[model samples]
Target: MLEKLQPNEIVDSIYQINLSHLKEKGIKAVIADLDNTLVPWRSTEIKDTLTAWVKDVKDAGLNLAIVSNNTSSRVHTLSEQLGVIAVSKAVKPRRRAFRNIASQFSLIPSEIAVVGDQLLTDVLGGNRTGMYTILVTPMSNHEFIGTKLIRQIERFFLKRIKNKST
Candidate 1:
């Protein structure tokens, strides 16, 4: 079943997350989303903070990679520059890319966390693959065509979260 996780499980921002804590939890790897999750969906340059974040992940002895639904060019550019593995045009929530990422890294699903801004694609995909999922706020109001539609649906679930929060 798709579990409705709390905000703590989702994390407020990428910087606030503690890799050591995740390591303690036996989470040794990460499969992250690119658009909005890491960048502004179309921003080409990586900020110092993002670069440092990736460095910290590696420094923490964690295997990391980018799994994006975007084309190879974009993911490859970002992944190569950041020194992480990548799978593009991922078609997420389908399990193909998620399974591939785990296999490539020789990581068990339980040992990985998938971080993304969208609940429908990233969160659902990660959960289906039995990985911990982190749903963050989108970097920009603009989203891909399909993602736009999903946001509308996500609001319904978010409303439930809001009600519970109150």
Candidate 2:
């Protein structure tokens, strides 16, 4: 169970992940989380820096999709702004949404990388679907109530995993 919760890589932020590296790894698609992972939770706009990152990934010939648990309106608005496909209200750790994105892109799970800020949602869900999972630190401490609770549980397990690695 714990192994399933672990991500293939953990990065400080999405900015640190290089699209060139992902391309070198043969990753054809990227299924990313919206809130916290891409931007601060509830933020409606994408800044200039993030826009450049998105452009870089696309320029590298990688498909990008936003799979978020946020409301459809929120997700749709942001996705439209970013010009990427999206799956909103995606109950993560569930393969349905992940599968949908993979199918839509016509790519196998192995060719995709699932990037997000949560373990239980992004990491576990991505791992279950056989995709490479990348976890990033949350953009801010200000989050929704449910996320706050999940973070507490995630921290406990993450701590244990760190200790075991040592």
Candidate 3:
């Protein structure tokens, strides 16, 4: 159970992810968490850097999708603006959304990489489905109250994972 929460890789931000490395690993698609992973929570503003990164991913021949636990309107609106696939109200740590995206893309679990800012949701969900998982630091300190609470528990696990690494 604890191993399911472990991320395959940890990066400070999405920008740091290596596109070439993903391709080398046979990752043809990337499913990303919307809030905090791509942008700050509930923020409609899309940064220029993010826009460029999306283009870069596409240019690298990778499919991209945005999955969020937020409302449809919020997720659709942003995903449309970015021109990527979107799945709203995903309820992560559950495998449904991830599996759905994989099916939609006609890709197997190993062909997809899941990237997100939360351990409980992104890492666990991806790992459960046998997809590569990348954990990125939350973009801002501001987030949902429930998420803040989960962060406390996440910290304990992070410490354990780090200690084990040594």
Candidate 4:
């Protein structure tokens, strides 16, 4: 299971991604999961740190977009503040959402990076599509009921992977 990636520690909010590293890797655009990945799930507004980071990422010549399985209102509100387009109700771990987002950026899967906090959704989705996936720890563990349940299963698998590696 560790074969797919060298799992990384959380970047401490979206603001912390090393833009230079990303640029060196030819990552011209970022397609991110908005909820737990960018902010606490359902968070209404962008934080000051994130707001600035968004600009930094853009200024560094990287385009940004949000791919979320949320309502248009929620995604749009956040997208407007972050200066990025958003695809609401993105069915992740499936290629459809990624495909649509990629089209928006005029990018191929290889040139776009997907950032999120979940393993099964973000990591798997990006990996499936051959996009670089960055798994950041969620800002808050308190999430939707369904997510809480999925996270339980995700942790179980993660622990299993760790044990075998040890």
Report the Cα RMSD per candidate.
2.0, 1.0, 0.8, 2.3
On residues 86-143, what C-alpha lDDT tens digit does candidate 1 reach at each position?
9999988778999998999898899999998877778888888889888788878876
| TM-score ranking, high to low | 3, 2, 1, 4
Clashing residue pairs in candidate 2 are none
- lDDT by residue (tens digit), candidate 4, 27-112: 99998888887888778867787888788888999999998877659888889877799888777878888888888889999888
Off by over 4 Å in 1: 1-8, 161-166
Candidate 3 on 64-136: residue-level lDDT in tens?
9998888759899889999999999898989999999999999999999999999999999999999999999
TM-score, prediction 2: 0.96
TM-score of each: 0.91, 0.96, 0.98, 0.89
Name the runs in model 2 displaced over 4 angstroms.
none
Off by over 4 Å in 4: 1-12, 160-166
Q: Rank candidates by lDDT, best first.
A: 3, 2, 1, 4
- The superposed Cα distance between candidate 4 and the true structure at residue 120, in angstroms, equals 1.1
lDDT of 2 by residue, 73-149 (tens): 98998899999999998999899999999999999999999999999999999999999999999999999998899
Tell how far residue 3 is off in model 3, in angstroms: 0.9
Instruction: List the pairs of residues colliding in candidate 1.
Output: none
Indicate which candidate wins on lDDT: 3
